[model samples]
Target: MNTFGLVIGLITLAVIGIGAFWVIRGERVLGYLWWPYFIGAGVLLMVTSGFIKNDWCSALAGVIGASLVWGATEFKEQAIRAELGWYPFGNHKKRPPFAKIIQKWKPPNL
Candidate 1:
């Protein structure tokens, strides 16, 4: 059992926990603070893919970076779902900050 692999798995789990927290609380915070994060992650992905000595580390970076990019799309859909009243908005005990952002985000009509 490679320790590096174990470390990577732990880091991935951490990412999942953080990402889930972000998703559950609300993606508006993410949207408001976007671009820099995804861009940095992309750069990190490329750098790790090229410079990392460990295969697991490089692969982990690539996966994480790609997931971040994909997460943007998922976040958008989550916003849409929230607008459509499909998903629970923010914490179950509190009202979501939906009016602040989603009100201004009108989806294109088909």
Candidate 2:
């Protein structure tokens, strides 16, 4: 069980690294490449169900599965933003709620 958990953790790390690299490369992987993450999460869930006797394994599996889903979402958001030409972190007029926060941190140029 411990070895299984370790393997899952390593796989999760690999997914994260690959996802991040794609993002950095500006390849727009997020818009259409989300299914592998779904498969990973589904597998984890299916495996965890059989690990009921090992509470620790079950819990770790759930957490790892959820994290993979979240990672896919992150990639998807970036992809959609790229497709739409929307750069959330890029230059833009500050909106209402954030405007006030920005004003507080204004530099000399502002």
Candidate 3:
């Protein structure tokens, strides 16, 4: 019986779980303004995965990349949750560089 698909699926599930956890923590500590950087990193990982020679490695990289993209889209909502008192609000969150520029653009949602 082939277990490749099963293994990959489990790995993906794990990655997604970790992604959700990080989205909350990241937003609280780093703030949602870093969404653009997350998107760029995710896209870069996905693009770089195409050049991998090992199938397992490529699949894992793709899963992680997709999770990052999903988490990035959730950052704005995460921030809202904190503001609404649903999540712990960080008093001294790190400000993203170019904060003024980022505020002018709409953050991604999914």
Candidate 4:
């Protein structure tokens, strides 16, 4: 409906799309890249929103965009786990309960 709203909507879609692409590529890559891209997209959406207006398109876009990206992330994680036969949900706790497999990383002595 308004100029800013349209921009926000487009930005949100772009964010979601990029996240999807990352997911489709694989979760390890997505996990490494998703958060930054998501944050950047959210900021851009809010900036383009300027002030809330009649078209709630930006809000809707934000919601859908977040969901899409998050869903993609989850999917990618699961896929990686499945591919590796490690855990159905990687280290997500809720799935493939493998807490015993602790990975302790200490900084090398300098």
lDDT of each: 0.57, 0.51, 0.94, 0.48
Give the runs in model 3 whose Cα sits over 4 Å from its true position. Answer: none
Instruction: List model 3 lDDT by residue over 1-110, tens digit each.
Output: 99999999999999999999999999999999999999999999998999999999999988899889999999999999999999999889898899999999999997
- Candidate 2 clash pair list: none
Compose the digit string of candidate 2's lDDT tens values, residues 31-68: 32433445466567857757677755665566556555
- What number of backbone clashes does candidate 4 have, counting pairs of residues 3 or more apart or in separate chains? 0
Looking at candidate 3, the ten consecutive residues that score lowest on lDDT are 61-70
The order by descending lDDT is: 3, 1, 2, 4
lDDT, candidate 1, 1-110, per-residue tens:
56976887788888767765565444544442243345456567767676878787777777677556555445656666765777555433322346455436543221
- State the lDDT of candidate 4 residue by residue for 25-101, as single tens digits: 44443332233344456455555554556556657655555545464335534555556766433333232123233
Top candidate by TM-score: 3
By TM-score, rank the candidates, best first: 3, 1, 2, 4
> Model 4 — TM-score against the truth?
0.34
Whole-model lDDT for model 3 versus the true structure?
Answer: 0.94
Worst 10 residues of 2 by lDDT: 88-97
RMSD to truth, every model: 7.0, 11.6, 0.8, 11.3
- Can you tell me which runs of candidate 2 are displaced by over 4 Å? 1-32, 36-50, 80-110
Best by lDDT: 3
Q: C-alpha displacement of 22 in model 1, angstroms?
A: 4.5
**Alpha-carbon deviation at 20 in model 1, angstroms:** 6.5
Cα-lDDT of candidate 4: 0.48
